[model samples]
Target: MQRSIVRLAIGAAVFTLFALHSAGQLRWRLLDRIETFTYDARMRLPAQAQSQAPIVIVDLDEKSLAAEGQWPWPRDLLADLVDRLFDDYNIRVLGLDMTFPEPDGQSPSRLLSRLSDSAVGRLPGFAAASAAVSAQIDHDRRFAEALSDRAVVMGFVFKQSVKSDEAPEQGVLGPPLFAVEDAVDYVAPHGFTGNLQGLQAPSGLGGFFENPLVDDDGVYRRVPLVQAYQGRVYPSLALSVTRAALGGAPVSLLFDPPAKRRSLNLEAVELGPLEIPVDEQVAAWVPYRGGYRSFPYVSATDVLRRSVEPGVLRDAIVLLGTTAPGLLDLRVTPVARAFPGVEIHANLIAGMLEGQIRKKPSYYLGLEVVELALIALLIGLLFPRLSPLAGAGLAAGVALAVVGGALLAWQLGAILPMGVPVVFTLFLFLAQQLFGYFVESRGKREISRLFGQYVPPQLVEEMAARPQVVSMEGDIRDMTVLFSDVRDFTSISERLDARSLSDMMNQFLTPQTRCIQQYRGTIDKYMGDAIMAFWGAPLPDESHALNAVRAALDMVAAVQALNPQFEARGWPAIRIGIGIGSGDMRVGNMGSEFRVAYTVMGDPVNLASRLEGLTKVYGVPIIISEITREALPSDWAMRELDCVRVKGKERPVTIFEPLGPKEELSSSVRESLARHRGALQAYRGARWNQAEAAWLELARREPERRLYGLYLDRVRQLRVTPPPVDWDGVFVFKTK
Candidate 1:
């Protein structure tokens, strides 16, 4: 029973580390995305559009084209319309939805044989002297030139992986118009902007990714900010237009990684006056003024040819797009079933100028952390001590209070994280109850195994007031494992008497091993001076690898940082050897059924020990199996520590040594790392003296290291009593 309690105490200490580290990482990612998800389309589109004034649209209708005759209108006719807007009505910009990729069909063939062809009248390089452009071509072409000269935002696409049979001259309008919310590679995955029937040449373009946002009920939600395409991020059509209207400021999507809050960037810079609440991906619900065609749709022929009165264009930004049945630009919208696309632009402009923006802030992560702590603390403290009914009542009250708190925070301009507190609270609470049922004693042991490495002993005791989460019967789970051993302990043991060895072990190994348990690593067993542990078992730990790998590093750190103090007291300094690996492992009681001992058993466990043994051969402290290295977060740098098979293994396992926290390692340290690897490689190649020189240098920096001293003694002995002639520089261990 006493032995069980000791194990429990150790497990609890380690278990707490497992809880805190995983809690920190998860709270960062999940909560961050949750915060950004609040940004909506209804608000942003309006804020930007209204800010850009003097905009208008021209729509295609059956009546306008019928009266104007078959579709392909002549350049002279377009030129005439341009003259009217510029000369007759004094409108400043005349954007065209039409392209001049083809020659004006209605130009008078023989009229331009001499000097009559103007730049606007002919295609860029027509062989024949272009004839006088027809009324249609003359009107539209002239209008395009005038608009082009008025600082109008020109639109065109880079044609990413476009179709081979597509018209070479045909183009979509604009570049990726906005930044991604949490984008690392800058891919636009949520927009789609299609081309019109070559109408008013685009002033600016957006909406290429244009994916519809669907709510929980499978209904449409908000508009997305950008579209990720071909691994590149692009801007939405609304964003492009807003950028153009706002005098061509670069537009980017600002994403906060921790909070997942999203806002718009104008002029390729930080988000200005427009702060729209969006998801971490910047996809949001687009509340419409009503469905499609809610805006007043006028015939293009009416506006361009002066058929409509002057007052009708009064201070209104017009958008030109199609509504004719054959064209199919018509679609269902909030206001109407057959909305004109042009009016969508106008509405956005109106909304922007009116300052209709909604904001989602970056505090979302903190809220989740605080809430989770609250729930975990509450459930742990209350459930065990209170009556079942009372516990149930308290839980219900807490739920109501939490929901109310969210609403209250929202009202006060604070968007608190909503789901995490509830989730963590429920998980911790339920796990404890279930733990109590199966093996309360074992559960306590399990807890010590997890948090013992990362937190203080006192803090762990405070947390013990809550529920226990350990179980004697382990469940299947993915985990990160760490294994470590003292180099040459067998020889070192031969030299000391049993009592001296025991005292030395207590002096050195006790504190060193305690650090591992402090990091919430599950202590598997101790083989003399060796310690074996794993992370992310007995509970779900998404950051299992990160926790275990980092804990191994921390163990080395704790030992090194204290070694000098040990030297001053005439005690031998401690040096550790560690190996880390991550993967699925079976963990449970593994001894004889009569005397079962809880432990993890799998390839990962073996590999972890192997990795640790390799550290001595490679002259480094922290070695990780390849799988564990790959599973770690990308922030840490690990040096490859050569590939080798242990005595009983066939396949070679690639081993790596973690230096320290990546941020603190310097050039001098890196140089030492480089020299150390080179010397270790030489030692493996039977260059014993070269290996000896490397140790000498390392000792210059770190004198009296336990592992290094062991190696130096072995080398001296080998020089005098060498191995057989066939000896390759391989060291083999007889037991685990």
Candidate 2:
């Protein structure tokens, strides 16, 4: 009886842990990745319900390359292909999965323009002679005219800037049908590379060809229907082609009223007669038919040669794109590794047209959580009360139930995660069956196994080998603590659905954790989108501050690299503010009896959190307290920010920004730093005029830099309200 009670207790505890993690109270990235793999497996189930779709691809394949020469094929050839699709084949709609960012260089008009600019066209009869040839040989003008008043859709791409505040203007665009409320939360493209005006103007309908978003595994899954660029919304190539096919009907976005409180949640997009479901980001899953060549593909050369059969393409919507390996147009998709990118759009268009695309909405998460809890409860209660044989039968039954339920959902065209619940149920069943056998060895074994999940492999190994060194007792140590929080996270969260948001956060936080761990720092905990980490615990480092500073700088650079992926994913480009502080603090495994964590705590740790909050105020990405700056190497380039008392702290402390190694500083930056230092001195010495003049010059030189402008504002305000003669140069902050 006692053994049964103990076994039940352990099984329930285990089930609770796994069940909570499955419910998303605690995230397990490995399980999430596994869920994607499971989804990929289920998605491979052949979609046999629909007939051959009405979409055909005009592939610029290897055969076309061999017959028609290399890509950037003369605009005349493209113009010929376009005319053939609409005129000869009677295709319903023509979509170009390509862009023409510049005028065709091989055109006779360009040659004539060059000649007119030089001494050649200036000759007596040469000008008139070339003018006649130029008008006839202007291929772009010919292509533009061919597309005018036709069922044609052109493609363009959006390029996001690394510096979020500055965006370059390019290309003309048509506005989207719907306005996204709280537009800041939407994934917005800051800049774009678009088609030439001559070509774009005549197409009358076009959309961006770029994905700019992908799954966490870098596989093409969902494609966005619309993207916001500089407050204007534009559709994608797939959406545009569908719209054109539907007689140019404007798309209607259906939103969930409940989610509108956070930010608008796009439930579905309505075309003329078809309604397609999409996630909050306005993206839909590509309902792949099978592997590559799932749709009919006719070579562009065949279309141009007029060698294709009559009714094969008649009334079919044809998308023009390349499949040549050298063209680099192939992409990794859930269905195929080397699928032509064009087919992805075709699948989406066809799936939406047929209403076969599976949708996993936000409400599905609640359903999954409930299902997991019930299954976990059943396993926990039944397994403990049954004999070994009976328990085995019950466990198998539960496994079959979970898998059967998942398969039923799949057959009905919905994807719910089954890996976690199935794995959790089986684990508990086996653990209970083996509990009596491993009773003597379970104590140390379980501790080692559980600890291994949280700490680094090296630390776990040492703790297992020397158990005396591991304890829950507290100790004081001089350590460096770092705090990092995503800027505008609330808005970011509002842009994505639960699963997509989770995947995006995982994609972002994984690299950051690597940066800290790479610098030998231990992560204390994650507070939502913020990370709290420390160096010099369990193992002490004399240069913990220097290591923390290096990690901070690397994290900023890492985020810069991550922005492009984020931009591509239609998720918001993110920025992080980092704060680092080094001083004596408490370090140990601290928590209640139920759950303890290896972490650090002290005034210095609290101050690090406070400093991170100031990054937004300072308009900088990284900030550090004076103690951290003092511990750094002399070669480090540091700029004094301010001497202020934080809201919760009593004493005033100085803050600084580290600008990497001194040797790497540019000459212009070095000069600005010199001027900045002089300005700081003048401001502290009560020479308002000198301070104002210095800051004005710095602000003019770097107009985008807010620090210089901030100082200018301060100097101007102080001049109007001069400080008392005995006043110190300390600023007091009243909020954290």
Predicted candidate 1: what Cα RMSD to the true structure?
A: 28.0
Tens digit of lDDT per residue, candidate 1, span 1-736?
Answer: 3323533343344335334634574234543343334322222233222233555565667887787765666655555554555555555333333334344556544344333455544565453334324333343344455554342333323333445655533434445543334434332322223343232343343343233453333333345555566555665545555555455665555444435443322211233455544554554334344445445556767766677666545544444456677766554444444555555545554444444433334445455555655565566555665544675676667766776776565444344554444444444544655555455535445555654554345434433433344345766668887877767777777777788778777666667666655665566667778777777644446777877876776777777777797668545566778888878888766678588766788887777877776676657788777787787767776776555667667666677766546677888778767776777687666678998888788778867444456556767877888877886655555544
Backbone collisions counted per model: 139, 4
Assess candidate 1 and give its TM-score to the true structure: 0.37
The 10-residue segment with the lowest total lDDT in model 1 = 41-50
Q: Estimate each model's TM-score.
A: 0.37, 0.57
Write one digit per residue (lDDT tens) for candidate 2, span 1-736. Answer: 4444666576667766776675679888877777777777776777545436689998999999899988778898888988888899999998889888788987878878988899886899997898778878898998888888898888988775646564465666644656655432455887787788888888788888888778777898888888887566789999999888889986776666734633346567788888888776777888888888878889889999999996889999899998888999988987788889999999888888888777776676666667666765676566555656787899888888888888888777676667877777777777776773476235446545655544556655444434555565699989999999999999989988999999988888888988887787877888889999998866667889998999999999999999999899788899999998989999887888998887889999999999999999888999999999999999999888888899978889999999989999999989998998999999889898898899899889988878888888887888889888886888889888
RMSD for all candidates, in order, please.
Answer: 28.0, 38.2
Tell me the deviation in Å of residue 711 in model 1: 99
lDDT of 1 at 283: 49
- What candidate 2 gets wrong by more than 4 Å, as runs, is 1-12, 15-25, 162-169, 182-185, 258-265, 434-436, 440-736
